[model samples]
Target: MDIFEFYKKMDADDIMLSFKGSVTSELLTSVLQIIEAKMERLNEPSKIKKKVYNVLVESLQNLYHHMDKNEQDIKGHSTVIFMIGNNAKAYSIYTGNYVRNENAEKLQAKLEKINSLNPDELKAYYKEVLNNGMMSDKGGGGLGMIDIARKSGQKLNFRFQQVDNEFSFYSLNINIAKQ
Candidate 1:
Protein backbone atom coordinates (compact mmCIF):
# COMPACT_ATOMS: atom_id res chain seq x y z
CA MET A 1 0.00 0.00 0.00
CA ASP A 2 1.17 3.51 -0.79
CA ILE A 3 1.14 5.16 2.65
CA PHE A 4 1.89 8.58 1.21
CA GLU A 5 -0.97 8.31 -1.22
CA PHE A 6 -3.32 7.41 1.57
CA TYR A 7 -2.11 10.34 3.67
CA LYS A 8 -2.43 12.72 0.75
CA LYS A 9 -5.99 11.59 0.13
CA MET A 10 -6.94 12.02 3.74
CA ASP A 11 -5.28 15.40 3.97
CA ALA A 12 -7.06 16.61 0.89
CA ASP A 13 -10.37 15.43 2.24
CA ASP A 14 -9.76 16.88 5.73
CA ILE A 15 -10.46 13.55 7.39
CA MET A 16 -10.98 13.83 11.11
CA LEU A 17 -10.79 10.14 11.91
CA SER A 18 -10.74 6.81 10.07
CA PHE A 19 -10.82 3.21 11.23
CA LYS A 20 -10.84 -0.27 9.77
CA GLY A 21 -11.40 -3.30 12.01
CA SER A 22 -14.04 -5.07 13.98
CA VAL A 23 -16.82 -2.87 15.28
CA THR A 24 -17.51 -3.34 18.95
CA SER A 25 -19.41 -1.39 21.59
CA GLU A 26 -16.22 -0.27 23.35
CA LEU A 27 -14.64 1.04 20.16
CA LEU A 28 -17.91 2.74 19.29
CA THR A 29 -17.92 4.71 22.55
CA SER A 30 -14.27 5.68 22.21
CA VAL A 31 -14.69 6.94 18.68
CA LEU A 32 -17.81 8.89 19.54
CA GLN A 33 -16.10 10.53 22.50
CA ILE A 34 -13.12 11.44 20.37
CA ILE A 35 -15.36 12.95 17.71
CA GLU A 36 -17.42 14.88 20.25
CA ALA A 37 -14.28 16.27 21.85
CA LYS A 38 -12.77 17.24 18.53
CA MET A 39 -15.96 18.95 17.43
CA GLU A 40 -16.11 20.82 20.72
CA ARG A 41 -12.53 22.01 20.40
CA LEU A 42 -13.17 23.14 16.86
CA ASN A 43 -15.84 25.49 18.20
CA GLU A 44 -18.35 24.28 15.71
CA PRO A 45 -21.85 25.56 16.18
CA SER A 46 -23.93 23.46 18.55
CA LYS A 47 -26.53 22.52 15.95
CA ILE A 48 -23.94 21.27 13.48
CA LYS A 49 -22.15 19.39 16.21
CA LYS A 50 -25.31 17.68 17.30
CA LYS A 51 -26.27 16.68 13.78
CA VAL A 52 -22.85 15.27 13.03
CA TYR A 53 -22.75 13.43 16.33
CA ASN A 54 -26.22 11.97 15.85
CA VAL A 55 -25.41 10.71 12.39
CA LEU A 56 -22.17 9.17 13.64
CA VAL A 57 -23.96 7.40 16.46
CA GLU A 58 -26.59 5.93 14.18
CA SER A 59 -23.99 4.94 11.58
CA LEU A 60 -21.80 3.12 14.07
CA GLN A 61 -24.68 1.48 15.85
CA ASN A 62 -26.06 0.22 12.57
CA LEU A 63 -22.80 -1.52 11.83
CA TYR A 64 -22.43 -2.88 15.32
CA HIS A 65 -25.90 -4.38 15.29
CA HIS A 66 -26.66 -5.15 11.66
CA MET A 67 -23.35 -6.26 10.23
CA ASP A 68 -23.27 -9.72 8.76
CA LYS A 69 -23.68 -12.51 11.30
CA ASN A 70 -20.81 -14.51 9.85
CA GLU A 71 -18.12 -11.91 10.34
CA GLN A 72 -15.49 -14.59 10.96
CA ASP A 73 -15.94 -16.29 7.62
CA ILE A 74 -12.36 -16.17 6.46
CA LYS A 75 -12.37 -12.39 6.20
CA GLY A 76 -9.57 -12.11 8.77
CA HIS A 77 -9.58 -9.47 11.52
CA SER A 78 -11.02 -6.56 9.56
CA THR A 79 -14.77 -6.30 9.36
CA VAL A 80 -15.70 -2.65 8.98
CA ILE A 81 -14.36 0.67 7.72
CA PHE A 82 -15.45 4.10 8.94
CA MET A 83 -14.19 7.55 8.08
CA ILE A 84 -15.26 11.09 8.94
CA GLY A 85 -14.18 14.29 7.30
CA ASN A 86 -15.01 17.94 6.91
CA ASN A 87 -14.71 20.22 3.94
CA ALA A 88 -15.56 23.91 3.76
CA LYS A 89 -19.24 23.26 3.21
CA ALA A 90 -20.05 20.06 5.02
CA TYR A 91 -18.95 17.22 7.28
CA SER A 92 -18.96 13.75 5.75
CA ILE A 93 -19.04 10.28 7.25
CA TYR A 94 -18.51 7.00 5.41
CA THR A 95 -18.89 3.47 6.72
CA GLY A 96 -18.46 0.14 4.98
CA ASN A 97 -18.99 -3.40 6.22
CA TYR A 98 -19.65 -6.90 5.12
CA VAL A 99 -23.25 -8.08 4.77
CA ARG A 100 -24.89 -11.32 3.77
CA ASN A 101 -25.43 -11.47 0.04
CA GLU A 102 -29.04 -12.38 0.62
CA ASN A 103 -29.67 -9.12 2.48
CA ALA A 104 -28.26 -6.72 -0.06
CA GLU A 105 -31.44 -6.40 -2.11
CA LYS A 106 -33.70 -5.72 0.82
CA LEU A 107 -31.32 -3.16 2.32
CA GLN A 108 -30.88 -1.41 -1.00
CA ALA A 109 -34.63 -1.26 -1.49
CA LYS A 110 -35.17 0.18 1.95
CA LEU A 111 -32.49 2.77 1.47
CA GLU A 112 -33.87 3.72 -1.91
CA LYS A 113 -37.29 4.11 -0.35
CA ILE A 114 -35.82 6.32 2.33
CA ASN A 115 -33.86 8.42 -0.13
CA SER A 116 -36.94 9.09 -2.17
CA LEU A 117 -38.81 10.84 0.63
CA ASN A 118 -38.89 14.55 1.38
CA PRO A 119 -38.49 15.76 4.95
CA ASP A 120 -42.18 15.85 5.68
CA GLU A 121 -42.71 12.43 4.16
CA LEU A 122 -39.80 11.09 6.15
CA LYS A 123 -41.25 12.52 9.34
CA ALA A 124 -44.56 10.84 8.67
CA TYR A 125 -42.88 7.57 7.84
CA TYR A 126 -40.91 7.71 11.09
CA LYS A 127 -44.11 8.32 13.02
CA GLU A 128 -45.87 5.46 11.25
CA VAL A 129 -43.02 3.09 12.00
CA LEU A 130 -43.06 4.21 15.60
CA ASN A 131 -46.78 3.67 15.89
CA ASN A 132 -46.65 0.27 14.25
CA GLY A 133 -44.09 -0.77 16.85
CA MET A 134 -42.41 -3.27 14.59
CA MET A 135 -38.81 -3.93 15.43
CA SER A 136 -36.22 -6.36 14.26
CA ASP A 137 -34.72 -8.93 16.58
CA LYS A 138 -31.93 -6.41 16.99
CA GLY A 139 -34.53 -4.00 18.44
CA GLY A 140 -34.38 -1.45 15.67
CA GLY A 141 -37.73 0.03 14.73
CA GLY A 142 -36.25 0.57 11.27
CA LEU A 143 -35.77 4.20 12.08
CA GLY A 144 -32.03 4.67 12.06
CA MET A 145 -31.80 5.39 8.34
CA ILE A 146 -34.74 7.75 8.55
CA ASP A 147 -33.23 9.52 11.53
CA ILE A 148 -29.94 9.87 9.75
CA ALA A 149 -31.65 11.41 6.74
CA ARG A 150 -33.68 13.80 8.86
CA LYS A 151 -30.72 14.87 10.95
CA SER A 152 -28.23 15.32 8.13
CA GLY A 153 -30.73 17.01 5.78
CA GLN A 154 -29.15 15.03 2.97
CA LYS A 155 -29.95 11.86 1.14
CA LEU A 156 -27.85 8.90 2.15
CA ASN A 157 -25.45 7.64 -0.47
CA PHE A 158 -24.87 3.91 -0.57
CA ARG A 159 -23.53 1.04 -2.66
CA PHE A 160 -23.23 -2.70 -2.51
CA GLN A 161 -20.62 -4.90 -4.17
CA GLN A 162 -20.65 -8.65 -4.23
CA VAL A 163 -17.64 -10.12 -2.43
CA ASP A 164 -18.58 -13.71 -3.02
CA ASN A 165 -21.66 -15.84 -3.52
CA GLU A 166 -22.29 -15.59 0.19
CA PHE A 167 -21.18 -12.05 1.08
CA SER A 168 -21.36 -8.50 -0.15
CA PHE A 169 -19.78 -5.22 0.89
CA TYR A 170 -22.14 -2.43 1.88
CA SER A 171 -21.05 1.16 2.11
CA LEU A 172 -22.97 4.20 3.26
CA ASN A 173 -22.06 7.87 3.14
CA ILE A 174 -23.71 10.75 4.97
CA ASN A 175 -23.05 14.48 4.78
CA ILE A 176 -24.15 17.26 7.11
CA ALA A 177 -24.09 20.82 5.92
CA LYS A 178 -22.22 23.50 7.85
CA GLN A 179 -24.73 26.08 6.75
Candidate 2:
Protein backbone atom coordinates (compact mmCIF):
# COMPACT_ATOMS: atom_id res chain seq x y z
CA MET A 1 0.00 0.00 0.00
CA ASP A 2 1.12 3.56 -0.73
CA ILE A 3 1.21 5.27 2.68
CA PHE A 4 1.39 8.78 1.26
CA GLU A 5 -1.47 8.16 -1.14
CA PHE A 6 -3.56 6.64 1.66
CA TYR A 7 -2.89 9.63 3.88
CA LYS A 8 -3.95 11.99 1.10
CA LYS A 9 -7.11 10.02 0.55
CA MET A 10 -8.01 10.09 4.22
CA ASP A 11 -7.25 13.79 4.42
CA ALA A 12 -9.40 14.50 1.43
CA ASP A 13 -12.15 12.37 2.88
CA ASP A 14 -12.00 14.30 6.19
CA ILE A 15 -11.68 11.11 8.16
CA MET A 16 -11.30 11.76 11.89
CA LEU A 17 -10.92 8.26 13.25
CA SER A 18 -10.54 4.91 11.47
CA PHE A 19 -9.94 1.45 12.85
CA LYS A 20 -9.74 -2.07 11.46
CA GLY A 21 -9.58 -4.70 14.18
CA SER A 22 -11.51 -6.95 16.48
CA VAL A 23 -14.18 -5.01 18.37
CA THR A 24 -14.06 -5.38 22.11
CA SER A 25 -15.76 -3.63 25.01
CA GLU A 26 -12.48 -1.98 26.05
CA LEU A 27 -11.89 -0.68 22.52
CA LEU A 28 -15.44 0.68 22.36
CA THR A 29 -14.95 2.59 25.60
CA SER A 30 -11.70 4.06 24.32
CA VAL A 31 -13.34 5.04 21.04
CA LEU A 32 -16.21 6.84 22.83
CA GLN A 33 -13.75 8.71 25.03
CA ILE A 34 -11.56 9.71 22.10
CA ILE A 35 -14.54 11.03 20.18
CA GLU A 36 -15.85 12.88 23.23
CA ALA A 37 -12.49 14.59 23.77
CA LYS A 38 -12.15 15.48 20.12
CA MET A 39 -15.62 16.99 20.01
CA GLU A 40 -14.90 19.03 23.14
CA ARG A 41 -11.64 20.30 21.65
CA LEU A 42 -13.48 21.25 18.47
CA ASN A 43 -16.17 23.00 20.55
CA GLU A 44 -18.98 21.02 18.96
CA PRO A 45 -22.48 22.00 20.03
CA SER A 46 -24.01 19.92 22.79
CA LYS A 47 -26.99 18.77 20.71
CA ILE A 48 -24.93 17.57 17.75
CA LYS A 49 -22.43 15.96 20.09
CA LYS A 50 -25.19 14.06 21.83
CA LYS A 51 -26.68 12.81 18.57
CA VAL A 52 -23.30 11.78 17.20
CA TYR A 53 -22.38 9.96 20.38
CA ASN A 54 -25.73 8.17 20.56
CA VAL A 55 -25.57 6.94 16.96
CA LEU A 56 -21.93 5.93 17.31
CA VAL A 57 -22.80 3.86 20.35
CA GLU A 58 -25.56 2.04 18.49
CA SER A 59 -23.40 1.54 15.40
CA LEU A 60 -20.44 0.13 17.32
CA GLN A 61 -22.64 -1.95 19.55
CA ASN A 62 -24.28 -3.53 16.50
CA LEU A 63 -20.84 -4.29 15.16
CA TYR A 64 -19.53 -5.69 18.42
CA HIS A 65 -22.51 -7.90 19.05
CA HIS A 66 -23.27 -9.19 15.56
CA MET A 67 -19.85 -10.11 14.18
CA ASP A 68 -19.64 -13.54 12.58
CA LYS A 69 -16.52 -14.78 14.31
CA ASN A 70 -16.72 -18.28 12.83
CA GLU A 71 -17.05 -16.99 9.29
CA GLN A 72 -15.11 -18.73 6.56
CA ASP A 73 -12.42 -17.31 4.23
CA ILE A 74 -10.45 -14.74 6.26
CA LYS A 75 -8.10 -15.92 9.02
CA GLY A 76 -9.15 -13.09 11.24
CA HIS A 77 -12.80 -13.53 10.46
CA SER A 78 -13.90 -11.37 13.36
CA THR A 79 -12.04 -8.30 12.13
CA VAL A 80 -14.16 -5.26 11.25
CA ILE A 81 -13.65 -1.78 9.86
CA PHE A 82 -14.99 1.46 11.36
CA MET A 83 -14.48 5.09 10.49
CA ILE A 84 -15.68 8.57 11.48
CA GLY A 85 -15.58 11.49 9.10
CA ASN A 86 -16.25 15.20 9.43
CA ASN A 87 -17.27 17.41 6.54
CA ALA A 88 -19.25 20.60 6.04
CA LYS A 89 -22.61 18.91 5.88
CA ALA A 90 -22.29 16.12 8.41
CA TYR A 91 -20.40 13.74 10.63
CA SER A 92 -20.31 10.23 9.12
CA ILE A 93 -19.73 6.91 10.75
CA TYR A 94 -19.03 3.82 8.63
CA THR A 95 -18.69 0.20 9.66
CA GLY A 96 -18.01 -3.07 7.84
CA ASN A 97 -18.04 -6.70 8.92
CA TYR A 98 -18.65 -10.17 7.62
CA VAL A 99 -22.09 -11.74 7.72
CA ARG A 100 -23.15 -15.29 7.14
CA ASN A 101 -24.38 -15.61 3.57
CA GLU A 102 -27.78 -16.81 4.64
CA ASN A 103 -28.48 -13.68 6.61
CA ALA A 104 -27.37 -11.15 4.00
CA GLU A 105 -30.65 -10.79 2.16
CA LYS A 106 -32.65 -10.56 5.36
CA LEU A 107 -30.44 -7.79 6.67
CA GLN A 108 -30.52 -5.90 3.40
CA ALA A 109 -34.28 -6.01 3.25
CA LYS A 110 -34.51 -4.82 6.83
CA LEU A 111 -32.29 -1.82 6.19
CA GLU A 112 -34.13 -0.98 2.98
CA LYS A 113 -37.37 -1.00 4.91
CA ILE A 114 -35.91 1.26 7.56
CA ASN A 115 -34.60 3.68 4.95
CA SER A 116 -38.01 3.86 3.36
CA LEU A 117 -39.75 5.13 6.48
CA ASN A 118 -40.37 8.79 7.29
CA PRO A 119 -39.88 10.17 10.80
CA ASP A 120 -43.35 9.33 12.08
CA GLU A 121 -43.37 5.92 10.43
CA LEU A 122 -39.98 5.12 11.87
CA LYS A 123 -41.14 6.02 15.34
CA ALA A 124 -44.22 3.87 15.00
CA TYR A 125 -42.19 1.05 13.49
CA TYR A 126 -39.72 1.19 16.31
CA LYS A 127 -42.48 0.81 18.83
CA GLU A 128 -44.15 -1.91 16.84
CA VAL A 129 -40.96 -3.93 16.61
CA LEU A 130 -40.27 -3.28 20.23
CA ASN A 131 -43.70 -4.65 21.06
CA ASN A 132 -43.31 -7.69 18.82
CA GLY A 133 -40.28 -8.81 20.83
CA MET A 134 -38.59 -10.55 17.95
CA MET A 135 -34.91 -11.39 18.02
CA SER A 136 -32.92 -11.90 14.85
CA ASP A 137 -30.17 -14.45 14.46
CA LYS A 138 -27.71 -11.82 15.57
CA GLY A 139 -30.45 -10.28 17.70
CA GLY A 140 -32.54 -7.04 17.63
CA GLY A 141 -34.40 -7.85 14.37
CA GLY A 142 -33.25 -4.61 12.76
CA LEU A 143 -33.82 -2.61 15.93
CA GLY A 144 -30.35 -1.10 15.72
CA MET A 145 -30.90 0.15 12.20
CA ILE A 146 -34.23 1.67 13.23
CA ASP A 147 -32.58 3.46 16.12
CA ILE A 148 -29.71 4.66 13.91
CA ALA A 149 -32.07 6.02 11.29
CA ARG A 150 -34.23 7.74 13.89
CA LYS A 151 -31.25 9.21 15.71
CA SER A 152 -29.51 10.47 12.57
CA GLY A 153 -32.74 11.65 10.91
CA GLN A 154 -31.25 10.33 7.70
CA LYS A 155 -31.75 7.27 5.59
CA LEU A 156 -29.40 4.40 6.31
CA ASN A 157 -26.90 3.71 3.54
CA PHE A 158 -25.68 0.16 3.18
CA ARG A 159 -24.47 -2.60 0.86
CA PHE A 160 -23.45 -6.23 0.98
CA GLN A 161 -20.53 -7.50 -1.05
CA GLN A 162 -20.19 -11.16 -1.68
CA VAL A 163 -16.92 -12.38 -0.22
CA ASP A 164 -17.27 -16.10 -0.90
CA ASN A 165 -19.84 -18.84 -0.93
CA GLU A 166 -20.35 -18.69 2.79
CA PHE A 167 -19.98 -15.05 3.68
CA SER A 168 -20.67 -11.50 2.55
CA PHE A 169 -19.21 -8.22 3.74
CA TYR A 170 -21.85 -5.88 5.12
CA SER A 171 -21.09 -2.18 5.04
CA LEU A 172 -23.15 0.59 6.66
CA ASN A 173 -22.72 4.34 6.44
CA ILE A 174 -24.60 6.77 8.69
CA ASN A 175 -24.48 10.56 8.55
CA ILE A 176 -25.56 13.07 11.19
CA ALA A 177 -26.04 16.67 10.14
CA LYS A 178 -23.92 19.35 11.78
CA GLN A 179 -26.68 21.91 11.54
Candidate 3:
Protein backbone atom coordinates (compact mmCIF):
# COMPACT_ATOMS: atom_id res chain seq x y z
CA MET A 1 0.00 0.00 0.00
CA ASP A 2 1.03 3.60 -0.54
CA ILE A 3 2.30 5.62 2.41
CA PHE A 4 -0.70 7.89 2.62
CA GLU A 5 -3.10 5.01 2.42
CA PHE A 6 -1.18 3.21 5.15
CA TYR A 7 -1.39 6.21 7.43
CA LYS A 8 -5.06 6.63 6.74
CA LYS A 9 -5.71 3.08 7.84
CA MET A 10 -4.15 3.70 11.23
CA ASP A 11 -6.54 4.19 14.13
CA ALA A 12 -7.72 7.76 14.68
CA ASP A 13 -7.76 7.52 18.45
CA ASP A 14 -4.11 6.52 18.45
CA ILE A 15 -0.87 8.34 17.74
CA MET A 16 1.07 7.00 14.77
CA LEU A 17 4.78 7.26 13.98
CA SER A 18 6.62 5.93 10.94
CA PHE A 19 10.31 5.67 10.15
CA LYS A 20 11.95 4.88 6.86
CA GLY A 21 15.63 5.00 5.87
CA SER A 22 18.43 3.62 8.00
CA VAL A 23 17.92 2.60 11.58
CA THR A 24 20.26 4.81 13.57
CA SER A 25 20.68 5.32 17.28
CA GLU A 26 19.90 9.02 17.00
CA LEU A 27 16.76 8.45 14.99
CA LEU A 28 15.61 5.76 17.36
CA THR A 29 16.10 8.03 20.36
CA SER A 30 14.10 10.78 18.70
CA VAL A 31 11.34 8.37 17.88
CA LEU A 32 11.25 7.21 21.46
CA GLN A 33 10.87 10.79 22.66
CA ILE A 34 7.98 11.40 20.30
CA ILE A 35 6.30 8.18 21.38
CA GLU A 36 6.71 9.06 25.03
CA ALA A 37 5.15 12.45 24.44
CA LYS A 38 2.24 10.88 22.68
CA MET A 39 1.82 8.35 25.45
CA GLU A 40 1.70 11.17 27.97
CA ARG A 41 -0.87 13.00 25.90
CA LEU A 42 -3.00 9.87 25.77
CA ASN A 43 -2.59 9.40 29.52
CA GLU A 44 -1.64 5.76 29.01
CA PRO A 45 -1.35 3.76 32.18
CA SER A 46 2.13 3.03 33.50
CA LYS A 47 1.82 -0.68 32.81
CA ILE A 48 0.85 -0.18 29.21
CA LYS A 49 3.61 2.36 28.78
CA LYS A 50 6.16 -0.11 30.08
CA LYS A 51 5.03 -2.87 27.74
CA VAL A 52 5.02 -0.56 24.73
CA TYR A 53 8.46 0.75 25.55
CA ASN A 54 9.93 -2.69 25.91
CA VAL A 55 8.48 -3.88 22.61
CA LEU A 56 9.69 -0.76 20.81
CA VAL A 57 13.23 -1.20 22.10
CA GLU A 58 13.42 -4.83 21.11
CA SER A 59 11.89 -4.27 17.69
CA LEU A 60 14.12 -1.30 16.86
CA GLN A 61 17.23 -3.09 17.97
CA ASN A 62 16.34 -6.00 15.75
CA LEU A 63 16.04 -3.66 12.79
CA TYR A 64 19.32 -1.98 13.55
CA HIS A 65 21.24 -5.20 13.83
CA HIS A 66 19.67 -6.66 10.72
CA MET A 67 20.53 -3.56 8.71
CA ASP A 68 24.06 -3.46 10.06
CA LYS A 69 24.78 -7.04 9.15
CA ASN A 70 23.66 -6.42 5.59
CA GLU A 71 25.75 -3.21 5.44
CA GLN A 72 22.74 -1.26 4.26
CA ASP A 73 23.32 2.36 3.30
CA ILE A 74 21.27 5.03 4.99
CA LYS A 75 20.89 7.46 2.11
CA GLY A 76 17.69 6.66 0.27
CA HIS A 77 17.79 3.16 1.60
CA SER A 78 14.45 1.39 2.06
CA THR A 79 15.48 -0.82 4.91
CA VAL A 80 13.04 -0.76 7.79
CA ILE A 81 9.80 0.81 8.91
CA PHE A 82 8.50 1.04 12.46
CA MET A 83 4.91 2.02 13.13
CA ILE A 84 3.09 2.40 16.43
CA GLY A 85 -0.54 3.21 17.11
CA ASN A 86 -3.59 2.36 19.15
CA ASN A 87 -7.34 2.21 18.89
CA ALA A 88 -9.63 2.88 21.84
CA LYS A 89 -9.44 -0.77 22.72
CA ALA A 90 -5.80 -1.62 22.03
CA TYR A 91 -2.27 -0.48 21.22
CA SER A 92 -0.25 -1.86 18.34
CA ILE A 93 3.35 -1.77 17.12
CA TYR A 94 4.55 -2.84 13.70
CA THR A 95 8.00 -3.35 12.18
CA GLY A 96 8.80 -4.06 8.56
CA ASN A 97 12.03 -4.65 6.68
CA TYR A 98 13.22 -6.05 3.43
CA VAL A 99 14.52 -9.58 3.59
CA ARG A 100 15.94 -12.06 1.15
CA ASN A 101 13.39 -14.60 -0.01
CA GLU A 102 15.18 -17.36 1.87
CA ASN A 103 15.28 -15.33 5.06
CA ALA A 104 11.68 -14.41 4.64
CA GLU A 105 10.71 -18.04 4.35
CA LYS A 106 12.63 -18.89 7.49
CA LEU A 107 11.01 -16.02 9.36
CA GLN A 108 7.59 -17.05 8.19
CA ALA A 109 8.17 -20.51 9.52
CA LYS A 110 9.37 -19.12 12.84
CA LEU A 111 6.38 -16.83 13.15
CA GLU A 112 4.03 -19.65 12.37
CA LYS A 113 5.58 -21.70 15.12
CA ILE A 114 5.17 -18.86 17.59
CA ASN A 115 1.64 -18.07 16.48
CA SER A 116 0.59 -21.68 16.89
CA LEU A 117 1.28 -21.72 20.59
CA ASN A 118 -1.01 -20.87 23.50
CA PRO A 119 0.27 -18.39 26.10
CA ASP A 120 1.34 -21.08 28.51
CA GLU A 121 3.04 -23.00 25.74
CA LEU A 122 4.72 -19.86 24.46
CA LYS A 123 6.01 -19.03 27.91
CA ALA A 124 7.35 -22.50 28.34
CA TYR A 125 9.02 -22.39 24.95
CA TYR A 126 10.52 -18.97 25.66
CA LYS A 127 11.98 -20.14 28.93
CA GLU A 128 13.32 -23.26 27.27
CA VAL A 129 15.06 -21.17 24.63
CA LEU A 130 16.33 -18.81 27.28
CA ASN A 131 17.65 -21.58 29.45
CA ASN A 132 19.44 -23.07 26.51
CA GLY A 133 21.23 -19.73 25.93
CA MET A 134 20.27 -19.90 22.31
CA MET A 135 19.92 -16.15 21.87
CA SER A 136 21.84 -14.63 19.02
CA ASP A 137 24.29 -11.80 19.60
CA LYS A 138 21.55 -9.48 18.41
CA GLY A 139 20.02 -9.87 21.90
CA GLY A 140 17.29 -12.13 20.65
CA GLY A 141 17.00 -15.59 19.31
CA GLY A 142 13.27 -16.14 19.44
CA LEU A 143 12.49 -14.51 22.75
CA GLY A 144 11.45 -11.14 21.37
CA MET A 145 8.45 -12.51 19.53
CA ILE A 146 7.41 -14.53 22.53
CA ASP A 147 7.91 -11.53 24.77
CA ILE A 148 5.73 -9.41 22.50
CA ALA A 149 3.04 -12.05 22.53
CA ARG A 150 3.13 -12.39 26.28
CA LYS A 151 3.26 -8.68 27.01
CA SER A 152 0.54 -7.81 24.54
CA GLY A 153 -1.52 -10.78 25.64
CA GLN A 154 -2.40 -11.36 22.03
CA LYS A 155 -1.30 -13.48 19.14
CA LEU A 156 1.38 -12.05 16.87
CA ASN A 157 0.11 -10.45 13.68
CA PHE A 158 2.23 -10.42 10.52
CA ARG A 159 2.24 -10.16 6.75
CA PHE A 160 4.73 -10.69 3.97
CA GLN A 161 4.67 -8.65 0.79
CA GLN A 162 6.63 -9.88 -2.14
CA VAL A 163 8.70 -7.06 -3.59
CA ASP A 164 10.35 -9.15 -6.26
CA ASN A 165 11.45 -12.68 -6.95
CA GLU A 166 14.40 -12.27 -4.62
CA PHE A 167 13.08 -10.20 -1.76
CA SER A 168 10.01 -9.50 0.34
CA PHE A 169 8.92 -7.03 2.96
CA TYR A 170 8.27 -8.80 6.23
CA SER A 171 5.85 -6.96 8.47
CA LEU A 172 5.14 -7.96 12.07
CA ASN A 173 2.56 -6.37 14.34
CA ILE A 174 1.98 -6.72 18.08
CA ASN A 175 -1.22 -5.51 19.66
CA ILE A 176 -1.97 -4.95 23.32
CA ALA A 177 -5.25 -4.22 25.04
CA LYS A 178 -5.59 -0.79 26.68
CA GLN A 179 -7.56 -2.29 29.51
Which one wins on TM-score? 1
Q: Total clashes, candidate 1? A: 0
Question: What is candidate 3's lDDT per residue for 84-152, written digit by digit as tens?
Answer: 877777777888888878888998888889889998998898899889857676667767777877777
Model 1, range 68-105, lDDT digits (tens) per residue?
44555535624789999988899999999877777888
* Candidate 3: pairs in clash: none
> Candidate 3: worst 10 consecutive residues by lDDT?
70-79
- What TM-score, over all chains together, does every model reach? 0.92, 0.91, 0.85
- Every candidate's lDDT: 0.87, 0.89, 0.79
Estimate the overall C-alpha local distance difference test score of candidate 1: 0.87
| C-alpha lDDT of residue 16 in model 2 | 96
- How many clashes show up per model? 0, 0, 0
